[model samples]
Target chain A: MNHRIGWLIAGLVLALAGASQFLLNDYYQRVLSVIAINIILAVSLNLTNGISGDFSLGHAAFMAIGAYTSAVLTLPVRMKAIVLPDLPVWLGQLEVPFVFALVLGALLAALIAALVGTPVLRLRGHYLSVATLGLMVIVQVVALNWQPVTRGARGINGLPPFTTPLWAYGAMLLTVGIIWRVVHSPLGRAMIAVREDELGAACRGVRVFRTRLAAFIIGAAFASIAGGLWAHLITAITPASFSFLLTFNVVAMVVIGGMGSISGSVAGAVLLTLLPELLRRVETSLALGGQPLYGLSQVVIALLMLGVMIFRPGGLFGREELPAVLARFQRRRSAQRQAPHPSPSS
Target chain B: MFTPTYLAQQLINALNLGSLYALVAIGLTMVYGILRLINFAHGDMMTLGAYLALAGISALVLPAWAALVLPMLVIALVGVLIERLAYRPLRGAPEVAMLITSLAVSSLIQNGATMLLTAQPRPLRVPSALTQRIAFGDLSIAVMDLGIIALAAVLMVALGVFVKRTTIGIAMRACSENLRAAQLMGVDVNRVIVVAFAISAGLAGAAGVLWSSKFGLVDPFMGFVPGLKAFVAAVIGGIGSIPGAMLGGYLLGFAEVFFVAFAPPELSGYRDAFVFALLLIVLLVRPAGLLGRGEVNRA
Candidate 1:
């Protein structure tokens, strides 16, 4: 709740991530890293979609930009020439450190978001959603068709696996911290005001468009970083990997976690990420007759999403942080204890 | 390549594609007109229709006409059931909730189909008579293409008459204009919604059959691309206007077919990109679309 405790928790998470390098198996470590990356994505998307009330279905497009950019940058120069001969001469000769490549990728994604958001943010509701979806498809088409730079669907592969649990968790922490700071800032209030009522926010001098553009750009940057981490972790990159399905998964996380709730995003990311793995195990071990339930996880997740939307549309945590929820629970428990037998009728 | 015959052949191709898009887009516009919901699962409905037709023909050994009719009827029922189960509960909820619910429904249908029927593409066989070519000088056209165009035209006219002359159709028009006022005027909102879903799903089913027949394949995910294009068409024609959807569909079909036919061979792969880019341009220039009246923020 306080800065001290927040710093302490952040440090503890990093420590666990470090310990996982030695203590956990490669598979578990990879899963942990993926969880961190998903947290980054879900939380960043929350900034635009939840806090700002802009429903963008193009988060994966930003992620794709980041992944492709970082993958192109961090490949060994010799490998780059072999895999991407059509890349510009300077790009083919250049290779950057993983962190720099990640930052550069994020920057590029943010820049594009700023450009696209200017025209797109004008649309409202489903129109905005469809416009973003269009952006996503356009990105995919370019990635698939740009043979010289993107290898024309072959995708640049055999990249250095630069993503580790440490880097992923660190980026995850940074993303959450930045979003938290934004949510508590004046700019954050302006975003919420704009989301609640655009006309009223304008009347109150919120600069509605600027506030939304800011969130859009910020969300895009983090999504790009998440993409960079994902590409490096997978050690392969393809346009197909960044399809609308990925966006759907992230949206599922944000929705199940609670829109506008940072901690909720984190919780949702962990649950949904692990749910598939758990389901995969269940699917393999348990089957109807002789058939394995290959796509059972997707069915269950979709059903869960539907159930959540119908029953608890606010998601698991609603708009409150974990600490606030726990505090509320504590207060309720003590009050119940104090009034155990006070009165039945009153 | 730029000869009149070549141009005429391309025009026929455009008409074929446009008819398919218009059929799908009409369903989308009709649903949007009444409920203001985008119905993301409509595409999956097409997928289901295609699959159902496949089952009817291949498994049930039904005649071609019977196969087509059965799927339309089944999908219409499925559409009504989906509305009752998934959408009806979230009626007064925020628009986003319904949108997300539709996405969930889409996922359910897609994955459910994948689980039941393998993800592999299945061949959909059309009757030989339908696939036969009808030659007009150098411009040869498939009988299937003619059938699609004719069927689409007939359906559109039938739908036009239904909407204009039928009591339920009038009620639908009233509901689209003002759902609350229609309800206040003693119109059955539930029946109107159900009818909208049924008609949309039935048309989507027909489009799905034509799509599978023309392409000679049926797959669980086959409807996604066409469905998305049809959605773009719906937006272009004004989301809630049936005639607007039809015009948008034809324009998009021409744009796509022409862009692919005329663009450099190297740029042909960017056809989907071109379509989406057009969508962005349209949204920026005319957010309400060509036939759309006023701003789109009804909520």
Candidate 2:
């Protein structure tokens, strides 16, 4: 690893980023917060997609899982009390706070993943993709009909407000940090090996199912945290909000940032999140003739996804990072600063 | 709790829904078997087929036969065009790329329709001749629904004969079984794929008319749900199998309608839920789907 100075620099960059969110207005801050959540989603998705090479479109399904789980758990017993009038006074005032809800949301999503991923993971290619997609549709269908739990499609609104820019970015950083550790771990290496070639990976003694399952559940867990954060930040929840479009957006971000690169995921998330608002602003300032209109953001997103897929399947950064990347930089710096270190030592 | 009339009504609904699913799924299964890609834009193809049918019908009320025939022709051509323009170029690319491209094409079609044909929903015209209902005892079925069932059956038969007995059909089957082997045998693989798309589009075109007439409304986005279900049907039946696609569609339709009919009203909204839950269970139990051949178990 690089010396503490590189770590210090990374920390400083994140700190400066955190402090700037406070400077922005509340709405802008909230948008930035959403970006942070997407960062978690895109990066977590990369764990399965970029590194493991699975087109798991049902990722937003996990987001829905997280959101609904957190919504049920995090919404004050008081809010539920007034909404239901079921005579449980202690439950109404008993808010479980934001962080706890996020953890529960991640756990719920992971639990569902374990259940769904087991058999479905046996299928591969578009079969696996479609099956996972079916998993999502099933979850949505359950959420829509399980009125006692999810409030059906009328949606579960009025979640506690806990996702500020600081909290969201903080969660974002923690998610990225943890995922980075996971990816650098031995398990992450095996997952990548399977992705490169399943037959070869199996021959080399990798447990294909376990590796795939770990990636699947972990991705679900982080996605749920993002969902929890999103639920609270918006303070309003609906199945419609976490529809296929959300999935498309997150996939787009991961692709744009570079599939396997954590840095790329963050870049993609921030760019895509800020892009709609920026485009909406630009669309307002400019116009086709004089009529006020919107939703071209979808057009841009669709085009970008198509363009990226067609032009650059390897994504922006092309998957090479973290294996002596820090050491390479340190070697260069030490050579410059000390001026006596042997270049051959590397 | 089952009455003759109620059973009859559900059967008629199932037939109507099943035929539409058949139309959409046949094409899907053909491509899945041959190319091994799920054209996510397939739903949009159905939408495009309906719109084209609507456009043809809009100019002047043609006789029912002419209306159905001409629209199918137009949509079949459109399907071939899509293959040439989009699917062919991305032929050897990863399935994910093709999937995303299909999505792009889908958004392009929907929004393009919104821009060109007016964003508002339009009523699709059903010929008065075909709109009448035939009654048997207390049970009644619309002519359009009956016609759709009959037509789908005929097409399915015709398709089976064409694919099995004819030279092109045999070639298509050969290509689907082994692309490399068929290529070595001098089959024009590209031509076969285009034909597959054309057939798919034609089926969708026919289904489009029935779909619109039954629903009494037409919009650019109409294909989304049906397309999805047809894909589901394809998966259920077994991707790449013609009979599987049709059978899957009927099973799903019956399952959905039955759930809606029997389940509690609050749970009625779960018709799709039950359908998908059934799909997941199917995935767990029979990962190749009910009739699909299993391959690549460890991805």
- Per-model TM against the reference: 0.97, 0.90
lDDT of 1: 0.88
Model 2 agreement with the true structure over A303-333: per-residue lDDT tens digits: 7766776778656655755435566778788
Worst 10 residues of 2 chain B by lDDT: B110-119
Candidate 2's docking class is acceptable
Off by over 4 Å in 2: A1-6, A84-94, A282-294, A322-346, B58-67, B111-121, B296-299
The models' CA-based lDDT, in order, is 0.88, 0.78
Give each candidate's fraction of reference contacts reproduced: 0.65, 0.49
Q: Which candidate achieves the best TM-score against the true structure?
A: 1
